[model samples]
Target chain A: MPLPSSIAALTAALSKLPGIGPRSAERIALHLVQSESGAVSQLADAIVAARVKVHLCTTCGALTEISPCEICASPRRDASLVCVVERPVDILSVDKGGTFHGKFHVLGGKISPLDGVEPEDLRIAELEARLQAEPIQELIIALGTDVEGDATSYYLAKRLARAGLKITRIAHGLPAGTGLEFADELTLSRALEGRRELS
Target chain B: MPLPSSIAALTAALSKLPGIGPRSAERIALHLVQSESGAVSQLADAIVAARVKVHLCTTCGALTEISPCEICASPRRDASLVCVVERPVDILSVDKGGTFHGKFHVLGGKISPLDGVEPEDLRIAELEARLQAEPIQELIIALGTDVEGDATSYYLAKRLARAGLKITRIAHGLPAGTGLEFADELTLSRALEGRRELS
Candidate 1:
């Protein structure tokens, strides 16, 4: 009457993943079942291996096979500058730009009262410890422009203001290749507020 | 400079799955790395378990935990009528209609010379063996309406004509919930040719 129990179980498990819907999960499950056993086994082994080996860097909370992560361990990186992000994945977005040569600090999540995520729930304590231990000159908050991200940024700014560090948020503006008509009012307002002199 | 070797390996492995592109694979890999170890472990275990537990039904070639599968083992189904399909997943689509109570025969794939899929490459021999063994009266070809499907259907019809069994294909027409404007010329032509008169 229904899909086989094993297939149904696999579909349910796949549906729990981000970006995977019920239909997509069912398709993937069916594909896996129909695929070669060796390929499926390899996928399973890869997942398990990644889960077992990858872990959050103790120094910056970024995902890494090593405790400190390569970024934290690299002496060439600017230790004086620390970029704070919401999750380990956010680090990849920043890293891909190849602009910043500083170290990173993953907050694990934003300060969302609705989601019951407070500042203490994040890796703020580890950040504070790093601030005290490292000669950090600036803290760049590279968080989302949402309400939660704003609240978290504001909270971090206030908490770390006494530490005599230069705190700044990434400038918001019309995205590249997007016209003014496509820009939302909030983004336009932020662009106006963050306008710099082009002499 | 690049992602950790383990993370990259997981991403590559995930990308190999159907419907999962490189970007989606990367996102899933990153999510797994960030997720609780228990949850990732569960997904891995589920994949392996499904791969290990599920096998092709010996009687009909459908995926099932059992060798014969429920459909093949059940006596309630019309054993005299066999519905031929391209893949095991196609059986699910037919079964969902809840109209056909006949047994299913998965050919694994259609005849595609371009793809190097021949009749011998499919489960045609097994189907012929079933025809000789079972009290099959009629065979319904429920394959896709593609060129390859038509070729396969024609081939099977010729091969099985000597057996004196009635062979019919599922009709092609304008799909439900679609307007004539959306119907292709070939489909419209088929619908016109297959039109029936009201009594």
Candidate 2:
């Protein structure tokens, strides 16, 4: 069915997502209209509600419905141990590991030199403020391993190391359950570099 | 910038497009508001316009802005020849080849036993009606090579053969530029089966 003007408008509006093209946007718009009347309305409601209800957590810059956010508000989380990440999606991955019970700080983006993004443009000022204000003992840099990630890590490491806080880099290695033969050269090399005594 | 309720509603609506998840939807919604406001509104207008203006061509079930569609209305196209396809996108591929200048019949979908889809569920009745009403000389079947596609093709072939039409199947072979050595088992088998002598 050809969509209503408003619906088509909405579809065109949706084409802005990271990878969605025009055809995909049209297909999605049609699917939403066809399948879920309530869901469509809910999505509309959510968009409005989220935009109004959600804001970046002032403490960590993570997108949240609440001011302090659930993680920040929780007393169970170790405020002394903080994990610094590049994005909110990275938080989900770290949480799934079930190893870390610390708080998080989202930098929003990495320092990309080619893309004209610099350290000053990111949430570095906020991060430094947190370090000065909070009684944090250890700061784990859980940033990505890209070229920009390396620059950001090195920059953050040098800055934080001067503060006398126990700063540590997240260990890099082959993914669990991945075959040795299928591993990329860089990952294999990293695994070899980080090897420990079996004992 | 904060989105207005109406714009947010539209953004939410657009995110449901195929391959678009939640994050992409927000990005798109934001993008639409920020840039190409006129073009975005026009896209919305097109959807509404298409919805109101376009209808299924009563002759072949292809959605068209016009009643019979340009292809169906064109006298230059072969009236006695028909190409059967699963969807409208398939028309682009055939059109790109610039080979077929005949009429088209959109079947909508193929029979999938596992999915409870049957021939009775599709446009088979309409197809039969078209064959009975028109003086179609050749029926060229162009469906996908999936199991469901094969089943549908075989069923259609048997039915068309019984009707005494000069039915032909689109030749199946390795995709253009794919190396013979890297060909999958099923593709290699198909290539061998569809082999021809250069007489």
How many clashes show up per model?
0, 6
Highest TM-score: which candidate? 1
lDDT: which candidate is best?
Answer: 1
Give the per-residue Cα lDDT of candidate 1 at B191. Answer: 99
Worst 10 residues of 2 chain B by lDDT: B1-10
Please write out the lDDT profile of model 1 over residues A148-175, one tens digit for every residue: 9999999999998855699999999989
At residue A62, candidate 2 shows an lDDT of: 58
User: Which segments of model 2 are wrong by more than 4 Å?
Assistant: A1-54, A112-115, A146-151, A157-164, A172-199, B1-55, B110-120, B128-135, B143-167, B171-199
Per prediction, fnat is 0.76, 0.11
Off by over 4 Å in 1: A162-164, B162-164
Q: lDDT by residue for model 2 over B135-180, one digit each (tens)? A: 8888999999999889899899887774557888798888898799
- For model 2, residues A3-115, the per-residue Cα lDDT tens digits are 34444664576565457777776666555544444654555444444444546678886556566767778898899999999976566568778889998898888988799
